[model samples]
Target: MLIGSLLDEINKKIQELMGKYVILDAYYIRLAVYKAMNLQGTRKDSSITFMVDDVFYVLQKCIRRGISSLNTDCICTVINHANNILLTEYTEALKKNLSASNWTAVSQHLLQGELNNVSGRVQSENAQKKYITHLNDVESSTSCIIILHNESSEILQKMYLSDPPKRLKVLSCLEAFLQTAKFFDSLLSETLLKTCSTIFYKLVDNMLQGLLDLRYVISDEELLMTEVNDPFMHAFCDGLKQVMQPFKKYMTDTNYAKLCRILMPYIARSYEKVVMQMKFNYNGALRLDKDVQYLLSFLTNLTGISVRNKFYRVLQITCLLTFEKAEEAKEFLLIESDTERWPFTNKEAREILTLRTDYSEEIEQLL
Candidate 1:
């Protein structure tokens, strides 16, 4: 009876501290809850089950108040210990006894908190690259990927339903998915790729739309300046590159062809818009050549005849500008147009060259 009374008193004080001090007294509350639960004693005394329930009840109340109200470290510690206890000692019993809603809320809070930790740690340029590489190692070990796969359906549903900011927060974990794809042997990667294809398509679509929307707010001059000086385009391109990095090894030829088909039209349209705008703004000054070259450097990395053709057309226009050096333009065209030397297969090269001839007459007229 005295021990039970002490447990009750501890629970009461924990509730009081959480209600009053919130984050400031989270340490005390955590310690009090741990002491009241007395996990070691619970292992021996089945009667201590009630006390354990009371501890979780208090945690649920604190969690309901808002996960942010507690110190992150305190919450993490509590969740780790709680998960250990629940998984080992109370898994079957808790299903019958505990409130399902409370359990779910606690689980979600912990998962989201951990995911946010992963996101927060990789905000800088160098950190972002390093984190992606780390993902490859972690996924290969199956630790992070297993955790993600366990929650993937829920995460996907949440992402589909969430508002943009919330969805982006969830989608930030995509690097993990890419790493998983990279490490999977071809067959498994194909299956996961199909499952994730819609999500990736939507992500790329949204990103491209954001880039295109920049045209409305800024003049050609400001847009050029943004292309040259801002990090936004660099980040977007880098993200796409990261997404494709794994495909080189894991993607089958058919999947690669499909991916090219999906991406080519978007790339072509965006390139056309930029080139058209530049052409409209042209006044025989080479001021925008840097912008053209910047985009070209990134676009050249993409495959497909349509993309290559658009790039060639853009190069043709730039070469026609009075300020462009004829020798440099000729050299670029000669090097870039040799179908034999291109990245595509012989059959693909022949097809692209055949397609290129249709535009040849028009390009000559423009020149």
Candidate 2:
């Protein structure tokens, strides 16, 4: 019999007996119920399989409560069997019932289920299962809880503070940094971009500082002033700049300068790749005069170079001199146009060439 139906039958019997007996003892009543249930299902020494289709089915329904007492010896065994039988049905029901409010619970439960490894974890098994479950429950449906992060950070901190190896700590710090960033993105206000920037900078600072024990981590002080190469650093710097772009409308000159100072590291880091790409190849050889002049001036000032004198020959032919001289100078400087081959594609390559030539001419004029 169904557990619900059995429960209903037991409740009815209890009601009827309550009205019949003047001094009905609770213990005797309970024992009578257990005995009646046991008679319906054969009580084997190994396992208790309650037969629901037995005769006197109405009275045998009392076995529902006795199952608990009977489970004392083989509760795990019963749970295993019960779980095995109900697992499929439970998951199907859960899938149909999932919603945004309960996504977090579903994600957690699914993760735990994966860890249990009932469905084996192959190369992509864990990732694929997690991907499917996450996509279905959170990503695609937008109706499930987002597991932005787990307990990875807490575990990392404890490991680091104790006696973690240097290599292990570095990796842990990197993972923690990424996880914390993701967590903040999911939780923080969208308008609080600067707030996120500050947090991001702090994380970078922490990561760099953590590597201080390594010789290579402490780079040359001059190298710090040099342009950056890491794309992540560039992105971080750009993000800060974008966040503070609107501040000038409200900020005082002094406040703006202060903000710029705060953003300098980010800007420099982010601008490094662009600067290097510009130095490589610039195709706007004869046009973009103003842009070229600006780039030259900017580079000269930043690099402490008097481009007017340092690169006078190279710039002169590229701008004021003959086309032949310009061609010769380009060859001298190994200035091959990066976009010459990928004319129809490579948007970034085109932009770089345009910037590079302008900057090159500006530097020549300044020199």
Candidate 3:
């Protein structure tokens, strides 16, 4: 009975020390999490900020200290506090800065690396760096959350809980950071949408469609003379390379892929809209087919994603416009292409055929 009393006293003192430890560290944990969002002194290099590393390093230290007591409750205490700090101080600061960046106006009608007069946000080099750094911060935070979770789980596996179920119970507390990761993901996508879509569409409007839509397809001879690699397209390719360079340098590969998925569909829709509006003779259709192929090649090579599916309608239009026989086009559409996946109906294909200036009356009879 005397030994039992002394054991109780020791456990009670351990609990007290754990409480004091968490209380003492809470202030610094919050401080470290908040300081991670110090946008003002953030790196201008657009790399992942050291602040992210610092925040997690501090958390690791805190977790190490908290777990030394061998009390699961103590570990839970530290984790809950860190989770609160991340969801509140860290996430709120990111959201607040993103809100003020006027993300919606960041890339309005940017062409030839120049912002249109209507664009409120100037695309200054420094501003772009800062914006990219903010994006990188978000991505790094998300990535670090996964790394930290794995690290925490491993620490538990080896040191804290030998049983998998109990280990997972403790790890369940770590899932809170997954919510933070998801929030950062939404922010990253939102920023990319606000900036990249307009920038790319402007490149299309000025570089690709500007040349195609200029009423230059008046005669067959000029259409035949139109080289696949027009100076305008070359310029568009160069401009596209310039547009993609910064993203490659700064964005995580996963987010960079997200950036491409965001842009490609918008670009495809833009291409399809422009192609539908233009008058295409036989030579014009032939030249445009090559031009589309060229563009698809460049973008596919750059992004390493098969974007041909996105431009499916554009390809169908080109096929209908350039096909020598109506029956062959019908067979191709119904048999060669997947019926459910065909972007256009027979009626739509007929409508596209009407855009062909040099087409005979029978071209519309494909259906």
Tens digits of per-residue lDDT, candidate 3, 122-195, equal: 35434555566667778888888877777887787887445676666677887776877787788888878867
TM-score of 3: 0.85
Reference-based TM-score of each model: 0.28, 0.18, 0.85
Top TM-score prediction, candidate number: 3
Clashes of 2: 9
Q: Which run of 10 residues does model 1 get worst, by summed lDDT?
A: 130-139
Cα deviation at 224, candidate 1, in Å, is 9.8
| Model 3 segments more than 4 A misplaced | 39-46, 97-123, 160-165, 202-212, 215-220, 363-366
What's the best-to-worst order under TM-score?
3, 1, 2
TM-score attained by model 2: 0.18
Error in Å for residue 310 of model 3: 2.6
Over 244-316, each residue of candidate 2 has an lDDT whose tens digit, in order, gives: 3334433333334433444344433433333323222222232223323544464444333344443332343
Q: After superposition, how far is residue 336 of candidate 2 from its true place, in Å?
A: 22
Candidate 2 deviant stretches above 4 angstroms: 1-245, 264-269, 278-282, 285-367
Q: Which stretches of candidate 1 lie over 4 Å from their true place?
A: 1-201, 211-230, 273-280, 283-289, 302-307, 310-367
* Candidate 1, residue 237: lDDT: 72
The 0-to-1 C-alpha lDDT of every candidate, in the order given, reads 0.42, 0.33, 0.72
Candidate 1 structure, TM-score to reference? 0.28
